[model samples]
Target: MSGSGLSSLAAAMESAVQDAPGVRVQTDVLIRAATAIDHSGPGSPDWRARVAGAIEELVAAGLVECPRTKAGWDRRTLPELPHWVRRSAPPVAAPRMTAKPWHHLLHWVPTVDSERRLSSAERGLLDAVNRWLPAADQVPVVPMRERSWGLLGDDKALEKLRSGRLFVPGRLTLELLRCRSTWPPVQQRVLGAGTWLIVENWSTFESLCTAAEADGFDGRIIFGSGNQVGTRLAALADKGDTPASPVLYFGDIDVGGIRAARLAVTTAQGAGWPAIRPCRPLYELALASPHRLRVQPASADTVSWTTAWIAGELGQQVAMCLTRGEAVRQEAVGLEILGPAPFAALVADV
Candidate 1:
């Protein structure tokens, strides 16, 4: 490694260690800093070796210490580089939140902090909220993006408000401003307490909706529209009058699908909704289909957790298929497999 390259790597490692003293600087961070000075490029064969040599040079110069191992230095690969520590660096001060003039409304605005301060953007948003609150009842409801754009000059600014990243006065909320994304299409066949089937793909959603309409299925049929189900499930919380219902999710048997299902479950649970479960019968039908698509192999943990949701021989089949990098789409179990009375058989057993 060149002098400049070694210096840059040492600086980055020192900065990272000082930022979080006990924390190990990630291998990628060191690699990225080295890449800025090394002309060999990251794709080159000797890039990792060069990086490993530079780390050793830093360690020998007493710039950084490898905490993991004392010897076998020559045999260690770039990834096997010992945890780098720098205790001599000065302690980093905690960041103070920007104080704001809106401290008077601290009770109405739970996010306001005296010890901490708010950013200019947050203060601006709070100012807009204060101005909007008294007139909120009379102001016409508008889409969240539109209101966000009108106030903040950025249409998508309020997107993370519900996630608690941004603060809004209790009196003025996303609902009052109509900031919510359009609710995912839903067909309520059975009004009261019953299973709510959330399907991932459009084709599967249509097939289920058609079957429910034809058979008068005893539940709600929701179109998940892929991963959007994570955010869309919040709509269920708005239905205060309706009794709590069991939610079942059916999606493609792939990494993305599994992630979407997990996200939906978490989002639902966070919103105080019923726990979302895998629709076993639907999954079984999907697995039995002759058609299968080749997909990237999911992690062992993902495969294990997904199979745990489904029981018996079918879960094993799912695990085997995912392990082999094969996926089964929810559309596989269409009207042909679902038949006219799809929910009748699935809802009772689920």
Candidate 2:
């Protein structure tokens, strides 16, 4: 291997070790990660030989240590590298609420077929719900509209499937507090409690619903559905059935999240619902979470309105996330943190 190529391999190994001190990775993984930035194209047999030689150089330089496994060349271990600071430990896998209790809510969520397995995003949504629904629940639902189907970007035909009568049975519906829905009665009470929990992502929404119900939360829950939250929030605000209830929104810690929450509140205000705001407790937990991912930094407009609702330090964290392009996903908060007991304590005043 050339000196520069060896140096580049060493840097990638160092990064992997720093990202996860004791993790194991396949040779392909290391090769792919290295070549991603190198743009030299994944090498062939001669290239593979060069990679192996580079690994030996790293070992010789005392910068990386790899132990052979039964998997042979397929896998290697990286015991923490020298002079590398370990990233924060990953959050424990949060306990997921059982699906038995929320099967009705899964009616509109799609499933895999014989030809293809669930994609990462689909699995992500189902995983949030703990994959407990019947095999029938795995069947894909036709999207009723371009907007309803936008979340599943992979289905090129989803837009074409938009129509009434034919899509009504397959359409997803949200059960609201004190408002009757034409939707099935079984799915009507996803949350029996009166709390209005507006959640961002589908997985987070499903997980929060399961967590809330498990914790005996009787409140109603709504999916923010990305930027579409304003419409949902406005609808709730316009409801005369229930007195304006305190709505607690939980979303990712990023520019989009802040903007979504702000838009929801502004939309609610326009419809005369008491101004909704961020759930501070959730924000505090997100800020301290270990599962944060980096993105492009948040802009001034993203954090401007949200700053008023968040504490000084929390606001600073939001600003920093925007500046550093970091994000704390709502999933990081876990069912235990989002359960009724903590949720109640968090919004008791509201």
By TM-score, who's the top model here?
1
Q: What TM-score, to 2 decimals, does candidate 1 have?
A: 0.58
Task: Write one digit per residue (lDDT tens) for candidate 1, span 1-350.
Answer: 23544456556554555555354565566666666665565877545444555565555455565554444222332223443444443335434444445433334444443434555556567677666656567767777778888877887666545555353345445675545554554433443356788788888888777777677676777777677776567665555523366688889999888888988877776666777888888887888799989988775446545655554466667766777789888878888877744466865545
In terms of lDDT, model 1 sits at 0.63
lDDT of 2: 0.53
Runs in model 1 deviating more than 4 A are 1-98, 103-141, 149-157, 163-172, 175-192, 213-216, 239-243, 299-316, 340-342
In terms of lDDT, the poorest run of 10 residues in model 1 is 72-81
RMSD to the hidden true structure, all candidates:
13.6, 20.0
Which clashing pairs does model 1 show? 97-116, 97-117, 98-117, 98-118, 99-117, 144-179
Error of 2 at 168 (Å): 32
Q: Which window of ten consecutive residues has the lowest lDDT sum in model 2? A: 176-185
**How many steric clashes between backbone atoms does each model show?**
6, 11
lDDT of 1 at 151: 77
